[model samples]
Target: MSTGIVLHHLVDSRSQRVLWLLASPLSGEELQIPYTLKIYQRTPTKQAPPELAQVHPLGKSPVITDGDLVVAESGAIVEYLLQKYGNGRFQPPSEGLVKNIYYTHYAEGTLQNLLSNWRIYGMIGERAPWPLTYLSRIIMSKAQHAVLLPTIEASTAMVEKDLEESKTIWFAGGSEPTSADFMMLLPLEILPRAMGERIPKKIKEWVDAAHRRPAYQRALKAGGEYAYAKLLPEASEQ
Candidate 1:
């Protein structure tokens, strides 16, 4: 299964997005790129395993080594895989059709920001003073209620609206799923745990459709147990 493409994947990380692209139909039929998954388990703290740092400076998951060229960053890896292996399928030439590119980067930029903020905030609260821990939790919760939650609501609503307006089921409005779909999948899949009942029906429908895709399902199986697929009461508690 080694096409000289080695994917350093971590269980239940952003790495799933890259795995989706690797396991996609385009990869097998259109591009014919075979990849080997090098899985790394997260520490009890859920940080990257120490052995991973040897792969690259940060030792982050989703890092791929193509031949001698090592690549990192989920968006960058998706783009590289699409452009190099996509063979004109997902890599559209039309400059005007930028949604694919937009979504690839935007998923990390806009959507993940909300998720990362709360994760860090929650981590900080968890480590805070025994006397101040309750106060810290109250403050973070209030901030989420006042600011983060509303922003997340608007963002989810925006996606729902985009799908409603899209000519296709995906955010890119492409006839077929593109790199954008893979990029968007990770965050959206992770969102349910973060947003819970706040998730809109449109988003749920979109994720459900993506989940049903044979390629996506295959990736899920190969990617190992994805805790993020189902909405858990407290993901941070893990």
Candidate 2:
């Protein structure tokens, strides 16, 4: 399918997932997929810009435009890209339960919520005001050390587990790469910096593997540094 991919970039937000997807296995100049990376600066009041509403009714970042087709929501966009451009490159064969688990179930379900909550609360907590901030921190603390962190730890416990796990040498099940890896990368990348010492070693290894990729490096250079600085302003040099 001939389609254009436009990513609405927000500093240290889920949009980074889209960048990772574009940089992964499906990416190359030859794909002829022209992608527009739109950078949306955070408002002084810490709200998404009203201009985003013009792109889609919800006015959210990480929206993508393919010709006349407009898709909002990160999961939808990633799935669309996989089905449209992926050509079974990133996805495992849809033969059994594992493929079903990886594609139909994983992206939209538990891992999705975990990643979303982890990024939102984890990254924005320090900047948010009291009560709300306190609550978010509590939830993040529990989720990370108790739930999400442990799952990742167990998943990557063995080299065989890692090898059989996903494709793209990241998260999804394949030798190459996929949007699944992209979905998990953003939050995984930021957690160690935000949580510090609390992040598990296994997860760190997973992130290290993803980070070594040339495309991930390119994406980080292209957009992540500014986003990280924006997200963690306290750590940024004054």
Candidate 3:
């Protein structure tokens, strides 16, 4: 067996963020950390494969194995990699530390859950029978507007306000991307698609800039087709 970090990635999922971070520069230099990529395909219904459960009990993507140690969850995998191989990069300074941690947890702890429910509602609507499809869609739409949209808007607005106040494109307000950036990318990209509108200007710009990065491009190339890569600014050109 190879003795490096093994990333079990599910296509078009939050695992893409981990792939981007792995391909990202650890320091000022453009160097990507060495790792083995194990790709998994989602089911026809867009669910993770059962094989993933053998790697972690959750059967989720974005899990990593460093020898005997297994790290799961997107945020935890990001922190673990940065802790072990960051070489003093991808962390915020004292002033930005609090914001970094808040946004990092906020991505998964709050925003992801809202967006996930939105996706589940969409799936429910899509899978409904012909007789119930319209009704189901209406019901799901009502549920989303009631339970998901308000919180999503509030959270995105909070991010917008923070970015506007900081006067920087990045959440942590640093010259380089940090763990917060890695952790937040997936949800931010999903936000606009989920809402159909109400993508705050700053957040849209942030996601665009993230897509245009060299590291992000590299991750896409190596990770095969990602659903969100269509959001790339020059996607038409590609």
Model 2 poorest ten-residue lDDT run:
229-238
Q: Estimate each model's TM-score.
A: 0.89, 0.68, 0.91
Ranking of all predicted structures according to TM-score, beginning with the best and ending with the worst: 3, 1, 2
Off by over 4 Å in 2: 1-3, 93-100, 103-108, 111-168, 193-195, 224-238
Put down candidate 3 lDDT per residue, 1-238, tens digits, no spaces: 4577888999989999999988787622544556788999989977899999999999999899888899998989889888889888887877888999998898899998899899899889878999999999999989988988888888888989987876467888887778889988888887765666667777777888788789898899978669876753432243
The C-alpha lDDT values of all candidates are 0.78, 0.61, 0.83
Residue 58 displacement (Å), model 2: 1.5
Best by lDDT: 3
Better of 1 and 3 by TM-score: 3
Pairwise lDDT winner, candidates 1 and 3: 3
RMSD of each: 4.1, 6.1, 2.5
| lDDT score of residue 121 within candidate 2 | 55
Model 1 TM-score, all chains together: 0.89
In model 3, the runs with Cα more than 4 Å from the true position are 27-32, 232-238
Candidate 1's residue-wise lDDT over 83-149, tens digit each? 7877777653354267766777779988887877767777776678899999988887777667677
- lDDT of candidate 3 at residue 35, scale 0 to 100: 78
True-structure lDDT of candidate 3: 0.83
Candidate 3 Cα deviation (angstroms), residue 20: 0.6
